[model samples]
Target: MWEATLPSSRHYQIFGYPRVQTPPPLNKRRVCLRFACPSDLQSRLTMRRRASLRTLLAACLAVHVGCYVVERGDTRVNNHVLREQNLVLEERAENSVHSLIKVTESTSTTIPAPQCVLPPGMAEEIQGYQEVVDRVIDYVTTGDFKGQVYSHLANLVDTFGPRMTGTGELEAAIDWMVEQSIAENLDNVHTEDVQVPHWVRNNESAWMTLPRLKQLHIMGLGSSVGTPPQGITADVLVVKSFDELKKQGLKAAGKIVVFNPTWESYGVTVQYRSQGASEAAKVGAVAALVVSITPFSIASPHTGQQYYSVENKIPVASVTLEDAAMMERMQARGQNITVKLIMGAKNYPDTISRNTVAEILGTHQPKETVLVSGHLDSWDVTQGAMDDGGGMMMSWAALVVMRKLNIRPRRTVRAVLWTGEEQGLHGGIEYFKRHQHDHEQFQLIMESDSGTFTPQGISFSGTPEATCIMEEVLKLFHRINATQLTNPMTGGPDIAVWEKLGVPTGERHLARGLYYSYLTNLLHILNELFFYVFLALHY
Candidate 1:
């Protein structure tokens, strides 16, 4: 007989199965089978069908269980990965927090000293001086004292617009300074003769004619030679620095070398202006050009001194930053750019110059000298108002304060307005050599050559203990925001000569940039306060 298989359960049933009723026999294991009717076969079939359904349900349950187990394992893996990521994040956060704490602690630990710790019985004098400083500041700012000093400064600027070294304007400026010094009741107001070399710029222009032709704004560098009347035109060779030029070798020969290097700071990047020409000339380049080193792009031409080699000298100039950038981009694109240079610059025989010196003799100790000074000359391009005019004013105002307060120092205060400082510090060298014999009498020398920004106390070139004492004395200026006192001073160019000769030197740290925009209005106030405080302390 054929059997039917159930698809759901994989079980078979006989086609003709009989239903049997069990009856007890003589023996316990005895059983009887009866032949089934049609109805009995049908009942057997129903019972078998029910059993198959049960088997199917059990198989499905096993499959569902397997799926659940697999899902649980996957979930565990995800959780483990999440935990690791969290731990890494937490570690980074902790490290950052620790770093911040260290920086904060370091900053807080550096403590600055207090200003003005005076002895007993000086309370009244200190109070009087403080009051005077306040009043003077107010008066000066309000334009209450428009004195001869202001007229003199204005007259000087008008008489000689831009007084470069070895120029006619420079000579006129010197005469004006000498006359003013004498008029101010200063003693020994005379000029120390000096010889200065003259460098003249005639005609200069530069442009790029490569991927695109564009006119460039440029200025012939100071002390550069003029090109032949027709000028020299050649392919441009760009160099990032001097070292790169050496590697290029003869490739840079017979080409106009361009130095496109950038400076991170003023102190470091100034070398290119001083030595770029000489370096380029060494590599057989016909001419050289430098991109402006300034941060701002005003399209203004910046001119500075260029060193020339004895064996090889060539014409050099500075171009606007915009022009340089254009050239750089074009060159990077493999475009061949050409530059035509025409510099009408020349150097003449050395001519006579002067260093103006004036003095206010001390009543107590006339022999002991305190030298105060500033450079008298400036570049020809800008007004040089901040570069040195401000310094000159401050020195003069300080002297006026000393005289008004009638507190004579133990040492004579001599003010020297040095000339030809920009030209290799020639005037300072000469003055030092002239006074080499009497250098022993110099008690202190101070120079304010840095721009007049704002007063920021002073830096002293003396023993640690002496500098500490000076710092303490400067404490009175703390209220005026002149707080910090630096050690191991980089004395000004004028005072450097004196320092080398064993004289103690110092330099006032003026706040740099924009701090002195309103200097004219604030001059009187500062002057009065300086005089009052210094006199009270000294007397």
Candidate 2:
């Protein structure tokens, strides 16, 4: 730790700037500035006296130019490298507590925003399918098919607890989907067999053995190696980031690395869970435990897959938000903590599964297919009603609704319920490999795996012409508030695979909310997905 004290008596003037008067403190006329370096690097510099405050800073910067971080009254400021620029200035308002402005060499330029100019002749192209668009909007909004979609989804999830790949329940769900399609009078209903990896989690447990004995809620990551029969009992090393772990170096060896990173987004935080084990193993750690990637939880530990290095494999698991926070706080207080973890997870040989497909053949162009799909597999913990059960139902109900309405498009409308999506994209990969010859015939592809929340709009990914067509098609659903068309498109994993074939892909957007245990709430999503896929087929 390096400490620099700025006495109130000293007034300062910045380089090539006007002199400023110091504001007097209400009580004491003294202010102290403190900076800390990494523990391993703290021994390189010693706090020493100087004739003036400027001289003291010069001495601190002389030891390690870019190592020191300045803090005032417990408020941290970013550390800067003074290699190129000799002067760094910080300004603070007199009455405001948190107002800070930092001037550096790289802050001289301003970044420009990207252009998003729309092309011409969009409204003219939209007039071609004006009548069909109006019909789709009217049918989706005023249809009395809500109860059918809800009841079907509830029955599926309540019957099949978890639809893991290659499991009997997943196969049963696939068969049920096929039967429902046949009952709905959907044409070309069939199933394509796909081999999927089978990994089972028999049992898992974790407990804190030091500082205070406590049981931690944990779930073994998918495909993670299990501990020995005796279990792994080692001291806990808490790190907020991989960079912090690198700084520890050999100090992390022979310990259980617990990653307690702050919540960013799911895409950002999930990397820690997926790669934390291999990174820890490289440093000779016994095992790795990561905080769940979810933003909020009540003693709930979310589980996902973890990949291991071929040379350094180690056990990995996810702990609840509460347990991770507790262990991190204990470590920050300099308390010695140890954890014992036991997992009985193992992987077996690949098992046979299938992807369920149903189609409504086109009257004009039978070979041109407009595809809509959602994964049929999910994590093994919950009922999977929200993860993809709802998405599957949404896609299935789309074709059923079209059949009931006696609406036939110029291109075939296809609905596929995929399997083995949770473990990876096995079902989708197998489908593409088996049907690569027909790839050029695919007109448009969309999937609904996000969730079944209140429908907002659609996200489209395609060329400028396709985008303008989709924009005009969505305008018909203005009554339902689903007309927002964004250029930067995002869709589910299954549809993302079709982008390689230059097919236009899309996903239904939902209002920000969680999965409630109700089937009725998902009816809106069913209507939106049905309408979007209908327009994709016709246009």
Q: After superposing candidate 2 on the true structure, give the runs of residues whose Cα lies further than 4 Å from its correct spot.
A: 1-142, 513-530, 536-539
Candidate 1 regions exceeding 4 Å error are 1-151, 404-407, 513-539
- 322-362, model 2: which lDDT tens digit per residue? 99999999998999999999998888999999999999898
Clashes of each: 5, 0
Task: Tell me model 2's lDDT, rounded to 2 decimals.
Answer: 0.67
Q: Kindly list the per-residue Cα lDDT of model 1 for residues 1-539, writing each as its tens digit.
A: 11121222212111110100121122222212121212212111111112111110001111011101011223222222221111100101211110000001112111122233445645454455554455444444344443434554556666676667888888888888778777767777788998776877766777666556777788888778889888888888887666678887587889988887653333334556778888888778898888775544667556767777656888888887677777777778888989888877888988888988887787777887877777777777644555566566556555654554444565677888777777678778888888879988887777876565556666556544455445555655556666445433443766666655667777775444332222221222222222222332332
Per-model TM values vs. the true structure: 0.70, 0.75
Q: Every model's Cα RMSD, please? A: 31.9, 13.7
Q: What global local distance difference test value does model 1 have?
A: 0.57
Full-model lDDT for every candidate: 0.57, 0.67
